[model samples]
Structure formats: C-alpha cells, structure tokens
Target: MVSEEEGKILIRLARKSIESYVKNKSLIDIPEDTPETLKENMGVFTTLNKNGMLRGCIGYPEPIKPLINALVEVAVSAAVNDPRFPPVSESELDDLEIEVSVLTKPELIEVEKPEQYMDKIKIGEDGLIIERGPYRGLLLPQVAVELGWNVEEFLYNTCVKAGLTADCWLFKDVKIYKFSSQIFNE
Candidate 1:
C-alpha cells in the first residue's frame, strides 16, 4: 500500500504535469525526491474532472515504465489527447481535479464460459479489460462504482468499448482480465 504522503506526492506530480503541459506545452521534470516505492514499474491512469464530470482520462494498462514517469505522460495526455473531449485550456487549470490511479498488473481470468466472469468480478473493486483479435478496452475500477454498473453491465460496456458487439463477452474466443487499482484524487 502507498502511504498517504506518497499518494499526495503522486497527485501533486500529476497536477503539475497536466498544468505545465496545458499551459506551456512542456512536461515537468521528475522531482528529485521520488520515493523508491513510486519508482517501481507500475501502470497508472490520470483522470481530469471539471465540476464532478469527466473531462479527460488516460493511462498505461501495463507496467511499462516507472510509476512516476508513466503518471507524467498520461497526465499530459489526459489533458489534451483524450478523444472524448476538447483539449483543456489554461483558463480551466484552476477548476480541474486530478486523480491518479495506480494499477496492479492485470491477470487473465481463466474460465470455460462467460458466466464465470461474474463470480470473479467484484463491483467497485475490479477493473475490467476485454480483448478480441486486435481490439481491446479497459474500464477502471472506479468507473463501475461511479456509473453504478453491475457485473454484466460492466462486461457489456467493456465489449462495446472494445468496438465489439455487446454480447461479445459470451463468445468463447474473447479474453477477460481483471485488475485492482490504488486510486487518489485532488
């Protein structure tokens, strides 16, 4: 578990990175005092909200880089590259809330059929990833809690997000993965 102090440090770094990138087209240099726990390879997501609604969110689903570096990269991307919204303007800086979700590596959920997924998935706790062929989609854990989706609904939405039919999860070839996240926000 991340200490509260470390969580705060991560949040501040994400905020600074988003603000810097939005205002000046630059990424903040990593801080000098980053804790060793934060330097470990970890996947991270940065979410930007304005007035309690999603403005932008993006992340690495796999642990490809140090937690701190991935956080900075995704924080900036969430500000400007999320296709669902327009780029955040400098004027919006003060109003944005930054959330950082540090994710556990996703583990494949093995089962003979789709129905078993409900047994493995825990609402408000497990994030979902559905993949088929070249298509894939991930919904963070908080998404289900925030949207109040039950396990099946979560599966349906995740399928649609992967650009597949809503019933695709029922297909035997589909792959499902679950991961948990440590989430904190400003």
Candidate 2:
C-alpha cells in the first residue's frame, strides 16, 4: 500500500508533468528521495478533470514501467494524447484536477458462459477489462460507482468502449478480467 505522503508526491508529480508538457518545458526530475514503491514497475492511469467533468483519461493496464515513469508518461498523455479531447492548453492547468490510479494486475475470469462473469464483479471495487481478438477496452472500478451503473450496464459499456456491440460479452471468444486500484487525487 502507498503511504499518504507517497500518494501526495505522486499527485504532485502528475500535475507537474502535465504542466511541463503543456508549456513545452523540460520534464520534471524525480526526486532523489523517492520511495521504492514509486520506483517499482506499476500500471497507472492519469485522469484529468475540469469542473468535475472528465477532460481526459488514459492509462497502462500492465505494470510495464517504473511507477514514477508510468505516472509521468500517462499524465502527459492524458493531457495531450487522449483522442476523446483536444490537447489541454497551459491556461487550463489551473482549473484541471489530477487523479492517479495505480492498478493491480488484472486477473482473467474463468467462466463457461459470459453471463457468469457478472457474478464475480463487485460494482464499486473491481475494474473491468473485456477483450476479444484485437479488440480490448477497460473501465476503471470507480467508473461504475461514479456513474451509478449496475453490473450489466458496466459490462455493456466496457464492451461498447472496446468498439464491440453492447452484448459482445455474451460471445464465445470474449475474455473478462478484473482488477482493483489505489486511486489518489488532487
């Protein structure tokens, strides 16, 4: 688990990273006293919100890089690279709130039928990932809680996010995975 102080450091780092990117400045250096947990590889998502609405959200679902590095990369990418929104301008930095979610490795759910997957999910606690062939999409755990969606709606939305039909989870080749996250916000 990340200590409160470490979580604060991460949130600050995310904000600084986005600021530097928007201003075309050099990347902020990670502090020498950073904790080992931050140095370890971890999956992370950086979420940008303006006035309580989502501005951009992007993440790595696997622990492919150091936590600090992943945080910086995703923070900048969510600010500028998310296709759902235009690049965030320097002027918008002050109004933007940064949220960082450090994810646990996703575990695939084994089920004979797609409908069985619903029994394994906890609405406010487990993030969902749906995959089939080349298509993949994920919904963070907090999404369902925040949107007031039931289990079926969460699954349907995740499928839609994957560019599949809303009922794609019922298909034979579909795979479902679940994971939790430690979410920190500014």
Distance from true location, Cα of 3 in model 2, Å:
2.0
Clashing residue pairs in candidate 2 are none
Question: For model 1, how does the per-residue alpha-carbon lDDT over 102-177 read when each residue is reduced to its tens digit?
Answer: 9999999999877999899999899989999999999999998998899999999999999999999999989999
Compose the digit string of candidate 2's lDDT tens values, residues 3-115: 78889999999998999989985677777888998999888999999999999999999989999999988999999999999999989999999999999999998998777
C-alpha RMSD between model 2 and the true structure = 1.0
lDDT score, candidate 2: 0.92
Clash pairs, candidate 1, are none
* The candidate that achieves the highest TM-score relative to the unseen native structure: 1
Q: How many residue pairs clash in each candidate?
A: 0, 0
